[model samples]
Target: MNYIKHLNSVFELFTRDSRLNPTHISLYMALFQFWNINRFPEVFYINREEVMVMAKIGSKATYHRCLHRLHDWKYIRYLPSHNPYKGSQIQMLKFGTSSGSNTGPSSEQVEEQALVPYININKQNKNFNKHKLPKNENEVLDFFKKEKWPANEAKKFFNHYTSIGWKVGGKITILDWHSTAKNWMLKGEEIQKEKTLYGPSQKRDNLKIIKEKDYGQPL
Candidate 1:
């Protein structure tokens, strides 16, 4: 198989595949590397832990899900090994142009070959609009320091957003994360000022009085 041609063809397919997410692509590329190492074997055995590390997938559940999805979509043929000592089997489907073949398949041929649905241009555009999250906590910390915000606040911001899948309000996608971090900083400052003005004990007492007030009496 022509490595470059295969990659080009597969990537073109990936661009049109809306069902695939980043994790699926990452896992597939990792498997491709292993295939290359094995000299483009028709079939290969893969250890789960090694594949997971290569794909940067932390959870085993995620790894299996993407692998099974790829299998279901006909990108590869997967055969699970029930034995603990043996690795699983995989056979990558050939998508590259062969010596006797045309440069690219026709539209109908491509559809019939992979059973992929019609390309969704709007979904691809929406995926493009998503903001990229920090690779790790250190990146978040570095950005916070560059913005002259407290170093400790970076951890708080990173933790909150990461826990919520880096979304705004846990529902809306974050388009620009730097703006969100700055807003957190401003909110932190306002909270600090409130604490200074009211004192912790007085603030608690004020909240208690408000909660205990009788609404039945005339205003």
Candidate 2:
């Protein structure tokens, strides 16, 4: 049984009732941790000072007020003790109970239903930034057109990722395709530098070939 979800169900009701403040919620959660540790027993003891510390309640007045508020609201049943050595016993409502509804389940049903549903950390994050990223090569090329990237370099970037199924470093998915395009532009600068370095040498060789052909012709 998912006790956290059970607590969440109780909290849903609390959301409807605006009277429960953050302080009340904090104190309730502190009690909840104790209830969980003590294995959902019929009655759990509370150490007022310790609970105050756990809930970050600054004063005894606020602590007792919220504690009694929870009790009075039927969120928990409080049994007070006069003895300083003995702590008060609390039975938290582990399942459905309206503030004043007669439809509160029977004790047996309440015991069975007290244990409830699960909370999920759904894997929606994979698709979270997908929309913001380029969907295809055309979009990628168009995106780089306004930037400093050459068209061919943009195409190379697009094809590189497209061939590899749009993943980065073989495993991690690229969340931003534009960043990859920028990286392609940076790498292209290195290629352009190499071409520029050898460009004059190629021109010189071409000129020598033309001169040799002219010298052999009719001079």
Candidate 3:
């Protein structure tokens, strides 16, 4: 599977669910993509730098912050990978139930669940500010008008949004548009609106098509 595309879809799924935080959701998306690509059934070692690069995070500190956040969220369980000679051992992270109920006899079971941490990404934050398009009435209308995006194309648009930054509120609004866009795209109507949806620097239109051959069976 194309890891990047799969990551986009998985990110969308998590964004739709209000229960997940942006950082934890992004970490899980990266973890799942790595697992799917490597096809490792057992524990796998991942370096902090690798995660920073994969998630497009700014720094080692930011990467570790997100990692700790995911651990505290119970989305993943990790431990130091053993090495004969090393400064800091690699990390082995597992994605799935950390509750131990889903593991088999041979599987590693985490006994104590860590207390969840509160890492809020609120609207007033700088990250959130980056996603807020012009809220002005005329500007908003003109933004959409220039894009000529069908109301239904919201899903594709939101996927693009969350891929760049976790815009939770924007995601909620985009989902509503996605529902509307689906019907229009299906009927092959609103071609002009569809063209308008692809704003500058937004490549949601160039999304990689996942063909049946790629799946090798019904998805």
Candidate 4:
């Protein structure tokens, strides 16, 4: 299978309706990438340390918290296991569905899991509005940074680029954006808007203009 095509398909699965938060979608996408390498459809293992490393997260504690959240949200199922070769047996993951109806330990059980609906990546890509910006790497980085984007939001920024048809050597670029990076900045702006309109959640406060930097000269 074409690797880029597969990756695009996986990404499409997550961003379909925006039902899943970006972080969750990213985590699932990572898992899908991992699955492509292992080819272990029935059983796959991921440990806390490994997850942190893959996610580029700083703290193991934070990784554990995220893991728990994923589990609680039914994004993946964790089966206890003990392996002499490995640290922990967090066996198997079921992606694309929350309902226990479609996947589980057995193939038959998996067949019962509900299949989540996702948009066609090809369709979205065709429909996405291409927002051209500066081609200078520094200018691009600075523009987003000036927007008060978190250091970890590189992925979403990269996604924006792909959505706009930017490519390098005919390959899609991967960004370093962490899960909450873009959402945090967007949420902050939303909060500011809400405060301006509703006179704050707690008290009436002066509103500050958050100037967004313009895209530098296009290439």
Candidate 5:
């Protein structure tokens, strides 16, 4: 298989897929790495724990769910094993045509053709901001409300991020504003829990400390 072509094709497919989350992408990449290590075998056996560690997945439920979803999406063929000594089997579905084929264009030609659309897309998006952001405070408020978050928290999130140029730690640019907002809410919850467990007079500087951490990076 042409590794570069395969990754480009799958990533292009991923862009069009709304059902996939970061966990799904992480798991898929981990599986792809294992497939690579095994010399791209037609089928391979994998230990659940080993895959989970490679994927940085802590929960088995999440790992299994994403794995099954990938299978259901026809990205891979999964064969679960009942025996404790044997690992589960996986067959990665190829997205690109075989490089050894004689009928198609040469490898260089194929690569160039595959990159043409991306070149056009980059040119078209030259003037557009790549990050996802709300048009206004109202949009942010609406999203928070939809997620059952406090209206005031929406304002806080919008104002805070806006002041920082929608970046985490005033350095890294945020790609998904919605996910950032969700993380903001989660941090707020943690702060609230801390206050409840200790006292209302807890130092507010802790919030500033938390905000200093880079939230733009994926978990």
Candidate 6:
């Protein structure tokens, strides 16, 4: 699906809708991410606790309230499974396509276009990871320092990732460390811009992540 167009359609329709509060928007976005990961599947089961964390909701009532509100407002169709084991099934209706029925893409479309999601765990000791990074911890620090990145930030990246074994989403391997660092620099700059644009009080969160690899082997 055309992601930008889809978002535009939602914005065009929902810009004036009073029902869409900040909390609702956050929950919808959380579901939207799952929809993307599931390859735009209309119907999929989800873990409640995981989703709540993903949405940054502290209470089940707040989470369910926004979820059902989205459903009742035709943003999604929710089939509640009171059975925790069964979990709840959610079907996100395509925006600006049709009325709130299950008019979704076929399995073939999903398989062909959607990215499969997976999880990984660090197998090393609690403070170390077995997976190797493309660059040494010191090398990464040097690169960031050379790139004019902050020293503390550089150390923060090294410490966090080395401890976690360079996994993403807990366990996924990062294929390109250089690209990740590039993105990190970009993100830092972006956050700096936001801070400047919005004023000093809008401080960005301080967190850095880095990973490790065996010495002298091809990265």
Top TM-score prediction, candidate number: 1
Evaluate all candidate structures by whole-model CA lDDT and list the values in order: 0.67, 0.59, 0.41, 0.42, 0.67, 0.57
Q: Which pairs of residues collide in model 5?
A: none
For model 4, the superposed segments whose C-alpha errors exceed 4 Å read: 1-21, 80-86, 90-219
Worst 10 residues of 6 by lDDT: 109-118
Compose the digit string of candidate 2's lDDT tens values, residues 40-94. 5556566565455556665666777787878877777878889763457777776
lDDT string for model 3 (118-159, tens) is: 433341132322323433334434434555854345444444
RMSD to truth, every model: 22.2, 29.9, 16.4, 20.5, 17.8, 17.7
Residues 95-193, candidate 6: write the lDDT tens digits.
544343333222221111212112122311221322236566688878787778887888777776668776443444443344345445555665688
> Which lDDT tens digits does candidate 5 get at residues 72-173?
777788889897634578888877656532221122211111111112334323323455678999999999999899899999999999999986546545
Clashing pairs in 6: 120-171, 132-213, 133-212, 133-213, 157-209, 157-210, 161-210
Error of 4 at 48 (Å): 2.9
Report the C-alpha displacement of residue 103, candidate 3, in angstroms.
8.6
Q: Candidate 4, residues 1-219: lDDT per residue as tens digits?
A: 233433444454444433345445555555544444333233444443334434444444445554555555445655544654333323334333434242322222121222233434453343223323345445546655876665345445556555655432123222222212233344456567877898746643547544753222111
Give the range where candidate 1 is weakest over 10 consecutive residues by summed lDDT: 108-117
| lDDT rank order | 1, 5, 2, 6, 4, 3
